[model samples]
Target: MRVAMIGQKGLPAAYGGVERHVEELSTRLAKRGIEVTVYNRRWFSDYQKKTFQGIRVVTTPTLHTKHFDTITHTLTSTIHALITHHDIIHFHGVGPSLLSWIPRIFSPHTVVITTFHCIDRKHKKWGGFARIMLRLGEWSTCRFAHKIIAVSKTIAAYALAVYDCTAIYIPNGINPVKPITNSEQIIQNQFGLTHNNYVAVVTRLIPHKGIHHLITAFTGLNTKKKLVIVGGGHFTDLYVKRLHELTHGDKRIIFTGFQSGAALHALYEHAALVVQPSELEGLSISLLEAMNYGRPLLASDIDENREALSDYGWYFKSGNSADLARQLKKLLATPRITLERRAKIGQVYVNNLFNWDTITSDTLHLYEKLVAVKPGKKRRAVAAAFRLAK
Candidate 1:
């Protein structure tokens, strides 16, 4: 069956987890002989209609506004998809949900399936109108979708609690494991990393990410090691400028900005330990990626992270730099092999629970169920009647 995957950004997966999810899921689905098309914002002058790995990448006109980017993209994408008339339209994030009302009008034959990536209003990054937009978007999307996919049980519960809708809990997925070869030597030379020289935190540089807390905790640790921060954001330069002042040229804390492809894997492979200090998360793909590399994780104690890691990860009090520091020191004192063992356990947990193949197949099953209807049933007519009555 033909499927159109609409997202805030188009696929080559430059940054976020949702984009990565689309890239992996769509490509795998394509390999399985399912036709897939992904919609992306037209960012570069070089960008044009193209196919990347069997999935069609359709560029739609978008507004590069501070917060209205999604709304603009959704509007254009709605028009684009209606013209294409794809069999199923699977949307990622609540951004597109703002226009969820349009699917019934624009593409009636297409089934709308939405994946709730996170409870956006609760995000620390959102403010004022942005927060209000999120609430409205959530309500509209939840009401419109034939089926809603939640990334975790916690996320699913949040959706039901907020919207009172039936949502399927389908967590994010990662690819199979392949050991990193010469990862340590390569990263060491590239970033001037030394043996047990730092604690690594991989996350976008945002206030809610709790990076400041990690840095504060690391500074007070009485150790001579560095805190290697890997990630860049639109707000990155602002945060980095402030962070440099906070670190006071200590030179122990290094900000490596963003790394992708082989560089990302190499950093994860060689890090002494990986820390996820997010104030909020819905089953972080970063944590799962760390697990895939068999890296020990020190994550904030939150329901989502706890649910993902179970007892396999080391926990620190959320937003408490002191507690985090203590936890880090304790772990640093342990054998490297001990960390390795924890990582192995974490890997087992992810492989069993978070593989993309299982997730995609389960998602396809949900779609089949959603689209499936008895020949005699007049679902569209009934839906039309209800809409007219409303």
Candidate 2:
């Protein structure tokens, strides 16, 4: 089967969850003898090659602005997919799913699938207009897409409650990180961090990620250990600037702008604790990576984070800096032996639950089922009617 994946930045997957999802899922699908084409934004993917890891990478131009980048590229991609011969057109994220109706209208025969990554409208990054559009996108996804995959049970429940749509619950999966023996000095020399000497946060420096809250909480506490923030902003320049200002006087607070591969693996491996104080998430890849690396976790008490980690890690009140500070202090004071024990248990839990092979198999099964079941005449008629109405 030929599948066109739209709405992610690009492959190689340096940062974003959507990019990682596309990269992993598409490569696995290609290995299964399925033809997969990923639509990429020009800015995110610097690769001049058309193919990577057996999957076709098609780059499209977009207005590289924060608001326009995703939508413009998705618009162009959807138009391109309409003309191409593909069995399925899979869209990721709600922002791009807003245009799912375009494919439904133009190519009624092709199966359209969308994955609900999160309640993006709730994110602090979007303005009022963008949030409203995201809501409409959610609505479009529910009404137009042939099938929907929710990355978490919380997201699935939300879709069922809000849109009256039942979506398949397929949690994001993680690959196990082999322990690095040679990279210990890389962390020490570059970031002045030693094993178990600092707390690390691996996420974008956005308001919704609650990095500011973490900074506030970390600074209020009395500790010699450093706080390492390990991600860069996509379009959140003002928030990034504010983060720098918040850490201006504090030399203990380190900002390592977007480290991946061995360097990122080392950060997770050596850290005393990995904290994800995100106010919103749809099964964080970073959290899973930390767990895979056997790092003890402390996250916000949101449903998504709770569902992801269960009883394996610590939790603080969401958006409460004081509560986070208290939690941080409590975790720091805990015995190192206890922390390591919990980290081992968390690693086993992730290995059992979030296996990438399982995720790949399930996704492929869904695609096959959708392809085998032909669209009903009534459904096609309805789609044609909607096109005429438009």
Candidate 3:
């Protein structure tokens, strides 16, 4: 089957959960002998290559602004996919799924799949107008697409409650990493970080991510452990500056901008505790990776985080700096051996649950099931699929 992926920024994922999700799924599907084509936005991609890991990468043009970039790219990508006659066109984000109607209207024969990766309208980065459009995008994704995949259980329940759409619950998967050891010098020399002495949180610097709250919480703690925030902005410059202001020129706070590869793994390896303080998430790749590395975790108690963590690690009240400070103090005071023991148990648990191969098989099962149906029977097929999934 020839499949096309839209909405993610590009391949060779440096950051972003959607990018990593697309890359993992596409590569696995390609290996299984399915022809996969991933459309990359020109503004976000620096990759000059035509392909990666057996999957085709097509760089499509976009408007390059924060508001217009995703929607514009999806429109052009849908058009190109229609012309090229792909068997399935899969749209990733709610923002880009705004254009799913183009494919549904123009070419009724093609199978259109949309993944509700997150509720993008709730993010603080977008303005009022953008949020309105994003809300519309959510509506578009739910009603226009033949199949909808929600990344978290809460998201699926949300679809049923709000849109009355029975979105199939498919959580994000994590690949096991060989945790980098004996890299104390590599981390210390680059970022003044020492092994098992610094608190780490890997997240994009944005308003909704709650980095400011983390900074406030970290400062209140009496521990000598440093705070390391790893990631860059998603068109939120002023918010990033505000994060710096919240630090108040504290030398203990380290901002490592957009790390990947061995360096990132090293950070995860050496962290005493990994925190995911985001106010909201569909399903966090960062949260899963921390578990993948078997780092003792401390996450905000958002329903999404609770859904993923589930007695796996420590939790604090979401967006409450005082409670976060208290949780950190308590966890920091605990013995290292105890923390490692719990983290290791959590690691084993997550490995058995969220395997990438299993996720790929489940996804392919749905794809083949839908693609087998007759073209004119889309409405009946879609209803049946939804019923079966629910």
Candidate 4:
């Protein structure tokens, strides 16, 4: 089936979980013989439309501002979608949801599905006006879309509680990567990370990500384990500077910026344990990758993380540095388990739950149901599908 996958940022997945999700899912779907067109905002003056992994990458015009960029891109992409006859239009994020109104208004025959990754207003980056616009978009889209995909049961519960919509739960999936090149020594030398002597925290440097708490916790830990922070922020100077000041010039906590490819793989391989200290998450892809690599996880106690990891890793109180430090110390004090056992369990969890094949099959099943129904009558179609599932 022909599908249009819309994301705020274009594919090739520069950053963010949704972008990565689109990239991996689209590639896998294409291999399964589904035609996928991904719409991405052209960030650079020289950005050109290209194809990657048999998926068509369409670069559309967008306002580069934080508030208007998504809206502008959605409007333009809506125009594109309306003109292009596709079996379904799958939108990621609330930005595209603003234009969900358009498809119903114009081309009611096209199946429009959306996955609300996070509650927009609750995000720390948004301002008052931006938050209002986002909530408005969410209301408009969720009220009209054919189906809603929530990444976690927590998010699904939030959707029902807040939006009063019953969304299907389809958690994020990750492409597994086995350790390839041995670049640990090179990365260590470049970033000054000691071999096997540091804990790694990989996430965007956002307030809600709880990096500040992680740093504070790391500083108080009794053991000699250092903290290696990986990732960049939209407000890089503000957060990077704040994180540095919080650490107080102690070189124990190192910000290695954004590392990907072999370097990132190497870091994960040599990490004592991978920590995700986000205050909130909709099933973190990073945590999944860490688990796939078989590194024990030390994450904030949140519903989604708990749901994802369960007993596979250790959890600490969210945003509580003292509690986090205590947990880290306790884990450090405990003796290490056999690597083979840890790796085996991790692989099983990923293969059973987070594999792309399973996720894509479920996605296509939803798409088929959406496509079978006539346009402007989505609620009935959704009702029928739920009934059929039961």
Per-model TM-score, in order, reads 0.93, 0.97, 0.95, 0.91
Cα deviation of 135, candidate 4, in Å: 2.2
lDDT of 4: 0.80
Each prediction's whole-model lDDT (CA): 0.80, 0.90, 0.89, 0.80
RMSD of 2: 1.7
lDDT tens digits, residues 70-136, model 2? 8999999998887887889999999999999776766767899999998999999999999999998
Which stretches of model 1 miss by more than 4 angstroms?
44-49, 235-237, 374-390
Q: What ranking emerges by TM-score with the best candidate at the front? A: 2, 3, 1, 4
Better of 1 and 3 by lDDT: 3
Q: lDDT, candidate 3, residue 360?
A: 93
Candidate 4 on 1-390: residue-level lDDT in tens?
A: 899987548777866788888888888899989899988877722446488889988887888876778888888887887798887888888767877766665666788899978776777777898888888777765686779998889989988887788999988987777657656776667887655688898888988899999888887766777888989886456876788889988777888887777888888877887889998787898899888888878888899898888778888989899999898887777667753366458757876799877888888888888787767565655554345335
Q: Please give the TM-score that candidate 1 achieves against the real structure.
A: 0.93
Number of colliding residue pairs in model 4: 0
- For model 3, the stretches where C-alpha displacement exceeds 4 angstroms are 179-182, 377-390
Q: Which of the numbered candidates is closest to the native, going by highest TM-score? A: 2
Worst 10 residues of 3 by lDDT: 380-389
Question: Higher-lDDT candidate among 2 and 4?
Answer: 2
Better of 2 and 3 by TM-score: 2
Best by lDDT: 2
Candidate 1 per-residue C-alpha lDDT over 1-390 given as tens digits, one digit per residue, 9 for 90 to 100: 788888648767877878888888899889888888888887622456489899988888888865867788878887788788777788888877877666665556678888888877777767788989988878866787777888989988888887788789989888876766777777788898865567788888877788888988887777777789998765356776776777867778888887787778778877788999998887799988888878889999988899888888799999999999899999988898888887898888888899999988998787677667411234673476357436
Tens-digit lDDT string for candidate 3 (1-390): 999999999988989999999999999999999999999877676888999999999988788888778888888888898999998999998898888877666666788899999998999888899999998888888878889999999999988999999998878989988746557777988998888989999999988898888999999888899999999998888898998998989989999999998889899989999999999899999999999899999999999998888888999998999999999999999999999998999999889888889999989998998899735555655554446336
